[model samples]
Target: MKVGLKLNEQFTVSKHNIVQVTTFENEFHLALTNSEYLVISKDDKDNSYYYTHEFNGCLIEVPVNEYHRIQRELTEYFGVEIQDVSSDETKDQEQPEPTA
Candidate 1:
């Protein structure tokens, strides 16, 4: 489910660095550090999800579908490579049909 976020919400990034999320009419404001990182977490209830730093608190909770979309966006924005663990599991689960 999509978690609605309000303007002027502060999310911790580092011990001394915090990012403020704001939306002004048709514009959105978000500040990321030079060494920023993105981490997504899926809530146990209702498959709710959020994106945040590995060492920080939840920045925003998005819909389950948005989680992967946001992850891809972050990967491209940050120019980093993220391994897909789920894909590997799916590959391993595929088995050849037994001859009858």
Candidate 2:
């Protein structure tokens, strides 16, 4: 899939395992296995615009258009839907701490 991503951009795909955009470095440097590597994008700028996935130690960036395209392809290929968090919802859902 062709998705946009960026360098140093962070995304939380799950509890563990994150896809980072790196041009000069590999996952090995970060103590990660290459097998866990997913897909890289065509444009590095687009790679910066990701969901919750954090691209740590990324040397390259992916464009947003390309990234979205790849996301669409992956969603169809795996038949899984991807949901993004909305800032508006976050603000409205914030709760205050209880006091004694």
Candidate 3:
């Protein structure tokens, strides 16, 4: 299954290419079969994320905020459920409480 992912750029990745998708609270990671790691930040206000790939000793950053979208697409594409490993505490309020 070709999963359509829209990040900093458009991408069509095979379901097989992605070994698994795991999340720890806001952090999301994708383990690829090619030993490449894709990380997505929990930032939505910036509409971006910190994505890097060791491309010949160079780390290219890809700003992406479509984490949920990508997750949904991948689940739908592969017909699999996410094995959430986060606890209730980890799902706490995202915004920090302002202090005077």
The lDDT for every candidate, in the order shown, is 0.38, 0.39, 0.56
Error of 3 at 33 (Å): 1.6
In model 1, how large is the Cα lDDT of residue 76?
52
Task: Indicate whether candidate 1 or candidate 3 has the larger lDDT.
Answer: 3
Per-residue lDDT for 1-100 in model 2, tens only? 3232222256423312333322221111112244355444445334344344575433323465645544454445445643233466565678666799
Superposition TM-score, candidate 1 onto the true structure: 0.34
Candidate 3 lDDT over 1-100, as tens digits, reads 4444554454445666778776755555777788876665545434233333533221223434355666667778668864335676654654577899
Q: Which ten residues in a row have the lowest lDDT in candidate 3?
A: 54-63
Worst 10 residues of 1 by lDDT: 20-29
- Report the C-alpha lDDT of model 1 over 2-93, residue by residue, as the tens digit: 23222213433331232432332212234445544333333223322233243343244344455455445444544564334445556667
Please state the error at residue 82 of candidate 1 in Å. Answer: 2.7
Q: Model 3, stretches more than 4 Å misplaced?
A: 10-12, 44-65, 83-85, 90-100
Model 2 CA lDDT for position 29 = 17
Tell me, by lDDT, which candidate is best. Answer: 3
- Alpha carbon lDDT of residue 15, candidate 2? 16
Error of 2 at 34 (Å): 3.7
